[model samples]
Target: MTISKRTLIIYLVSLGAFILAVFYFIKTNELRRALKLSEENRDSIIYALNQRSKKMSELDSLLLTGDYNSALKGYKDQLASSDSSSFDLIQQRIELTKKFIQQSRRVVNVDSVNQDTISMDTLAENTRRPTAEEIRNYDSLSFALRKYQIQLDRLKSQLQKKSYGEYLTFSSKKGNSVHYVGQVQNGKANGHGIALLNTGSRYEGEWKDNLRHGEGKFYWPDGEYYIGEYKDDLRSGVGTYYWPNGEKFVGEWQNDQRSGQGTFYNEKGEIVAKGVWKKDELVRVEEK
Candidate 1:
């Protein structure tokens, strides 16, 4: 039996509605994911801002009351306990802390305040005068400020490089033996980071799509270390290899072997061999 024109039209409309519904569902999921990530980033930034604001208030109180020892002790404890990954969202909060600190410093550094035909220089100077404990506290605060500033600078560098992306740490399971910690993007270690292997060999540095790429340092379980450029997970390009037995090689490498020019040094820090090599074997020695 042939369907009537109206019936066929109704069936087509129903199929089209079904397709539209599926499209809307997929788009809505994507939007939800984006919103979730945005919310997380916002929360992290807000948390950092709150913590810094609290610290700023405490610093002001300490300075006003000359409670330098307590301030210094608390600052040190916080730094010691801070997690490395805690700064992953630092870029969002750096400006807030910097501005607050700058304003606080200015307020603290005022030399005098004018009041009712009297200059309050004496009182201001006395209040601002640094005691020994205050000096120590200021020193530690300065150091901590510099440290966080440096971290922000590194993050800025990473943003420029875009090699690691924003996320930190990429983990995998191929059993119970392997683990990784470092910069990750797109669910893989795509930036600078470290990986631990079951054999006790650990590699740290730049990565691309989960492979060791760019500059990296690999430490063998036997105490040997390879510091150099890597391509596709093999030591390539310029690098230095150090042996626990006091042997070292510095030079060009290709295809996981020494090639082109290189210098060999013994434990005495003296160059033992300088020359060309092929496939991990010395091909020619340079005339010293």
Candidate 2:
């Protein structure tokens, strides 16, 4: 078979064009795959960062509430679940919490001793009168207690500052101090956040227009705490209130008072009153 020169040249050109087209298509597909993989990796990294921030916030809440054991546990869990190299902050916090726990224990022990000594002195006074030596000893113990209390208070202040240092601080001439950290809109707290007061009180949860308008937890300096709904900066819904002495109230609230169906438990955890309450008083007792 004899072919023309022009015809042979045309066939070769077409074959070359087809091969180049196929190569271009393969490379384009590979490029698309790589881009998709890169996007996936970027999304994952963002998610991980968000999760870490949330965990750190939780730890901060625990610390502010003086829940050392819980804070320690949370830090440990985070460290265990994450790569240690990336969690140096968590490691440092764990150590800080341990020191705080030890200091708190010492304060508690001193307080216990003070209480025992007072009881003994009271009994002796009732029998007769405290001797000169006894009076001097009592004075010494009282002084010691005062010193220890001051130390504890200072430590608490330091802890609060460290935890809230990165937040916005507000101070007033009337000795009111508040530190807030979280979402802000229009120069006001508008979302989830934490607030700590100079009086050793703290609030963590939702905020609307700088008022506690949703669910939240409030902790007092004396170890009392409340967990429940909030409206307009007041306890306006169902909630649980716990006292330092082991008393508890679980029920409804209005304007920060117990104004609805609720149960009040004494220090022994026994229900002292279960009924309708009004203005912090049990108005009607419900038979159990």
Candidate 3:
């Protein structure tokens, strides 16, 4: 097989082109795989972000409700100690308390709940401190409560003055009663506030038209409690309900009923049921 120079050159060129074609095919496949994986990762991040945002919103709303509830309860305790029955004083104090609750909502609403983005520019400001603003709010409520106390004291000193004494009031709570100090608009509980009932029940959270329409916490006298989102006064969203004995339910809710993906844990923290729920019962039993 003695080949001429021209023939050798021709054969070499054909072999080189074939090798290049093979390499190009492999490289193209690799690039496609990389692109497909990147796209999948992006989708996963987006899905995760959406889920996290919703959960964060629910939590933020719940916490705002809690803070307002605590502040109002504290103020109510102060009012009771002063034996202050002054309707005018109570109303004035309520107005002041409303300011703080309003401030808390504003502070909590600004938190963003996005994570998993690889972009260097999206700095995670996910965890935040709600302290200083909360303190200022607490002080505002406290000041108002102290004013109510002083007014009661002044009325006591003026007992001899019938005109001044007549304006003061006193209450010896007659029955197991609960107290609530929060926003009331148009004769209905609206916005954030706390409630303590005579039956030893307590609720603190947002209200709309006198219904618990947002995130809130409800505690029974027995120490059982539900903390989560509410819609139209029903436990209609994601939340956690804990029994006094350490049992708990965590997941979706609809009309005060357990619905959607939820799990029930026994007193010992063992999962009793987990899966899709309907009317408070598990529809699909998930394998542990």
Candidate 4:
């Protein structure tokens, strides 16, 4: 079969077009697969965020009802199961949810319950409790408690507003006198406010019923800042503390002090020392 030049050219052109078509088809399929995978990941991220938010809501309700055990379980599960490297939005959602759950947990007072019950019963059955002045005093106390409760409710509402993600709260006390402020919700400095030390230092952050809870930032007049988790007005969990002497410590802190593994950095933000600190002192240090 002797092919003419014109026929040869036509065949070559057809073969080239056929190859281009096949290549285009494969490329389009690959692009479609990639897009599908991306969409799936996006949906997964959304689902995870939604689940975490819902858990947080449930946690709030549990906390309001004083169901700490269940709430704590949920909180721990959320923290453990969260994908920390997800998008910023997802990470924030998870962080805030965990914060709410952990913060709302009321400090259990094992001794106060029995003491309060006994005191209340004794007060109620006082044989000489018929004085008008005494009754008035009791009434005044009741009124004050109600007022406090109302204020607490309003503060919780403010926290809910802040938790929606658009506000920060801070408190300050001036002078040599010490004044306690309180813990806040949704990162607003709210709840039972207490000044820890009178030495011109302040810690402000998440608060629940006037106790420090969740992530808190504490600042001292001596040019120190501690940023990390807190429980019951104390630094507990991972945190970074900046000292006045141009040094910093970053590590897992507990009970308003450095406890566990940490790194002490020099003024240049270089890790000059690494060690386990207990009670704010280096128990062990490894120079690297």
Error of 3 at 233 (Å): 1.3
Better of 2 and 3 by TM-score: 2
Per residue, candidate 2 scores C-alpha lDDT tens digits across 83-105 of: 54335546666766675575456
Instruction: Give the alpha carbon lDDT tens digit for every residue of 1-288 in model 4.
Output: 899999999777766665544444444444444444444444554454455556656764563344656665765665565443223323343444344334433223001111111112221221221345544544554455455445544544443333223223233222243333233455544653324344545454576544567877776665677889988667899999888677988898887788999998898888887888888888997776
Taking all chains together, each candidate's TM-score versus the true structure is 0.44, 0.48, 0.42, 0.34
TM-score of candidate 3 relative to the true fold: 0.42
**Scored by Cα lDDT, where does model 3 land?**
0.58
Q: Measured by C-alpha RMSD in angstroms, how accurate is candidate 1? A: 26.2
For model 4, the local distance difference test gives 0.54
Off by over 4 Å in 3: 1-87, 90-179
Q: Write the per-residue lDDT of candidate 3 for residues 128-159, one digit (tens) a residue.
A: 33345544544554455455445544543333
Model 2 misplacement above 4 A: 1-166, 171-175
lDDT of 1 by residue, 165-279 (tens): 2333333333324345445677777776555565556666888887789999887666788999999878899999999889999999997899889999999889888899889
Candidate closest to the true structure, highest TM-score: 2
**C-alpha positional error of residue 196 in candidate 1 after TM-score superposition, expressed in Å:** 0.9
Q: Lowest lDDT 10-mer window, candidate 4?
A: 109-118
Say which prediction, candidate 1 or candidate 3, comes out ahead on TM-score: 1
Steric overlap count per candidate: 1, 0, 6, 14
